[model samples]
Structure formats: structure tokens, C-alpha cells
Target: MKFISVTTADGLKIIINLTKKIWPVAYGKILTMAQLDYMIDKFYNETALLELIDKGHVFYLAQDDNNNYVGFVSYELNSEPNKTKIHKIYVLPETQGTGLGRQFFELVKEKAIENHQKAIFLNVNKYNNAIHFYTKLGFTKVKDEVIDIGNGYVMDDYVMEVDILQ
Candidate 1:
């Protein structure tokens, strides 16, 4: 797989829609439809995504030899010192168990370290099975909390952090 930085608004749209596809596949069994819909509309909207890109966040779309986009990951350095947060990571259903997610995550780790980030953090829905995936990739659960995402909805997440510099 070849991973490339997204350079156009059209590319961003492809990433957002891919995000939608993976969200349902990864989160639907854990979250209610209403909750999932709220997240998709709030975060995957073009304007919202553009704002993220404008804020110095990095977005990557992974493609195969045929140029078929199969996965994506996005991350940003926040105000917190020495830390980078991975906002989203997803691989298509057909590629989930094929090591693509691991490759994408390693790319995220490289990007974080290149920026001098010592650690990386992300929140995973408690009911999702991806915790094992993260754990296998060296993330340790630091805390569990309910994040209220407004509109009477809340996400019960396990906040996991990985020490990339280690």
C-alpha cells in the first residue's frame, strides 16, 4: 500500500466518506444509530474537515497499486506539550485484518516522532473491539471517561496513550 498526504478538497471528501463507511463498520455495533449519525454529521462534514486541515493537522489516504483508496488516518499536535492526538484511523472492512491498520498506525507514529512528539493519544469507544488492536500496537489505557459531545449524547471512551518515543 502507498500512503499519501491528501492535497485537495476532493481528496478530503473521499477521506470523509471513507470515514463514514468505517465508522458504521467499527462503531455501529457499539453505538446507537442516532449517536453514530450525530458524530458523522458533526465531524465528517466538509467544512469541519477543511478546518482541521487548515489547522495544521495531517491527513493520509492509503491506496493500493491500482490507486484504490483503502484506508486513512488523521492526527494533530495539540496545545499539550510533547503530545499528538490521533483523531481518526480507519481501514475498509475488506482490509481490516490484512495488516493495513497496523501499517497506517506505524505511519502515524513516524509522523508524531518526526514532529518531536513524545506521546500519542486517542479515545476508543468502550464497547468497540479495537481496544485490543490498539493494545497490540502498544497503547496503554490511561483512563476511562464519559465525554459529552453535546446534544444529549455522550461517548464512553477509554483514553489510551502510546509512548512513541520509547
Candidate 2:
């Protein structure tokens, strides 16, 4: 597998396309259709993604040996020094158990450490099965949060963190 840093218009478009393919299947049971649509529009839109990139968010496209995009991860440094926040990580449903997620996460950790980040954190839906995956990857729940993202939807999540400095 390979991780490509997304920095161009084509790269952004690839991620957008990958998101459209990954989200519905990944979040289908975890979120209502309304919430899924709203979140997709709010986060995966071209403008939103470009804005995030402009703000220093780094996106990586994960591809297989055949060069097929299989997953993606996005993260950024936080206001607090030595901390990195994982903004997004998703793998296609078909690729879930093939270690793609773990590979992507390892890449994130490598990048974080390279940037001098001591810890990495992310928000996971309370009911999402990925919490178990994160736990297995050395992340522990730090706090619970309920974020109102408008449109009558709220993200009930657990903030998870892993101290990479260990």
C-alpha cells in the first residue's frame, strides 16, 4: 500500500470521490440518512475540503499495489503544542478487515511524530464499532462530547487519545 499526500486539485477530487464511496456504507447504520447527507455536504464538499487544506490540514490517500484508492486519513496540528488531532479516517467497507485502517493509522502516527506531536486524538461516534479498533490500536477514551452540528443532529462521541511518545 502507498500513502499519497493530497496537495493538488486532482488529489482533492480523488478524496471527494472516495468519500462518496466510503461514507454511506461506513455510516449507514450509525447515522440517519438525513445526518449522513448533512455531514457529507458539510465536510466532504470541495469548498470545505479545500478550506481545510488551506488551514494546514493534511490529507493522505491510501492506495493498494494496483493503485486503487482504498482509504484516506486527514489530520492537523492542534492549538496545543505537541498535539495532533485526527479529523478523519475512513476505509471502504470491503477493505475494513484487511489491515488498511491500521496501516493508515500507523502513517498518521509517523507523520505526527515527524511533526513533533506527542499525542494524537480523535472523536469517534459512541456507537461506532471503530471504537474497538481504536482501542486495539492503543487509544483510550478520554472524554465524552455531544456536538450540535445543526440540522437537528448532534454527534454523540467519545474523545479518544493515544500518547505516541511512549
Question: Best candidate, TM-score-wise?
Answer: 2
**Distance from true position, residue 153, model 1, in Å?**
0.7
Task: Compute the lDDT of residue 103 as modeled in candidate 2.
Answer: 87
Per-residue lDDT of 80 in model 1: 65
Score candidate 1 by lDDT. Answer: 0.87
Worst 10 residues of 1 by lDDT: 73-82
State how far residue 79 of model 2 sits from its true place (Å).
4.7
TM-score of each: 0.93, 0.95
Query: What digit string (tens of lDDT, one per residue) describes model 2 on residues 31-132?
Result: 998899899889887888899999999999998998899888999986358889989998988888999888888888888888888999999999999999
- The lDDT, on a scale of 0 to 1, for candidate 2 is 0.89
In candidate 1 the C-alpha lDDT for residue 154 amounts to: 94
Going through the candidates in the order shown, the clash numbers are 0, 0
Backbone clash tally (model 2): 0
Candidate 2 stretches greater than 4 Å from native: none
List, residue by residue over 1-110, the lDDT tens digit for candidate 1.
89989857898889887987888878878888999999899988888888988887888999988889999988887626889888888899988889988998888788
Ten-residue segment with the worst summed lDDT in candidate 2? 77-86
